[model samples]
Target: MRLTRRDAIAVLAGLGVVGGGAVAVDQFDPPTAETAETGETGDGGGDGALSATVTATMTAAAAVVYPSQTEGVADFVETYVVGRARDESRRDAMRDAALELDAIARDWYGDDFADLSADDRDSLLRELGVAAADPVADGTVSERIRFHVVNELLYAFYASPTGGRLVGIENPIGHAGGTESYQRATMLEDDAGRVERAERAGDAEDVEGSEADE
Candidate 1:
């Protein structure tokens, strides 16, 4: 699904972003000094917007994690990241993770993470072993990236209507289809089919028992 900037906001709302869109998530670690130092001294200023570097790194990361067919990815990712970063702790963690990714990118490819090709971004993430690491707030670089960057982005996308459709979910949790949606005629039909099959099996068993008695 093609996501507009408005759709991205709705996605954040679905994730329980409230109080003027400060951002919310099911799990995250409190801000640490390390992360604070990373952001406090960086280019993300007092305007409450995410830093350009953080936005670029996150958008690049989302491209690697989202389906190749995903549309309007750059807008969706930037909106989500900026909104989510309203929480100071979350923002710091994201900034720290983005800086780590940039550091790695420069070390390996002599370029920034956001500047690397898509294949390179994917390769770098795999090399960091984020795919295999459990996300922890203060864990290793891979773990922090897995938590603050990759996993959060995945959650935001999959929880949105567009992303959920890719996986055959017509309505993800927060989008609101209502009870009628759950009352599909196909479900009743399946129940009836099961009952019919059970009756047929019961009849066949009864007939076999009678024949044995005879």
Candidate 2:
């Protein structure tokens, strides 16, 4: 089933996944402006840190999940996922999700997800989605990937200004161009006849009153 941007948003919202306040991974300081600009997480920061490897994995995952017919997907992922993620814990979740994908790849094919052929990577993601949907299992890794990684990425893309344009939304939330005021359809034209009739009745009433006075 091909999911539209709206559908994806609804799903994420329904799951209570998107707007939750940030979770702190640890005491690691947030990314500096320079680090964010460079898209590097710096060195020796452990599981919570965003590294080049994590960035690469996220880039690959974004490509697979939200493939654009046009280009600039890498930049989009960097801006939305790496740069604009709500807080450190959110970033950590993204990093961990990528690592989870790698772990799944290793278990299935003896390779990292990044090393897998495109077909294999896609196949593995499909399986991951299936596993995530099991009703009996709650808070499983598959469920986390589905919500934290895949759904979050989808939300980020569609909620972005560029992604919004793809689906005909002018400017999304953090950018400019949101509607200043929502204009409702006016019924002036449809009500024109009724207005004219009321005017005529008032005129007739005035004439009758004048004649009675005389």
lDDT of each residue in 1-214, candidate 2, tens digit only: 1223232222222233343333222212345666667665432243444355565566677677775463565544543443333355665666666677778888998987777776787788887763345422235777777766667677666654345556755334543224421242422223243323323323322322221231
lDDT of 1: 0.65
Model 1 lDDT tens row, 1-214: 5754444555655554533412322112333465456643222233223356677788899989988887898877766776666566777788789878888999998999999999999999999999998999889999999998889888888776566656765455764443534666433322243223323323322322221231
What stretches of model 1 exceed 4 Å from their correct place?
19-50, 174-180, 185-214
Give the least accurate 10-residue stretch of model 2, judged by summed lDDT: 205-214
lDDT of every model, 2 decimals: 0.65, 0.50
The TM-score, computed over Cα atoms with residue i paired to residue i, of candidate 1 is 0.70
- Model 2 C-alpha RMSD vs. true structure (Å) is 19.7
Identify the leading candidate in terms of TM-score.
Answer: 1
List ranges where model 2 is wrong by over 4 Å.
1-50, 84-86, 130-138, 172-176, 180-214
Question: What TM-score should be assigned to candidate 2?
Answer: 0.56
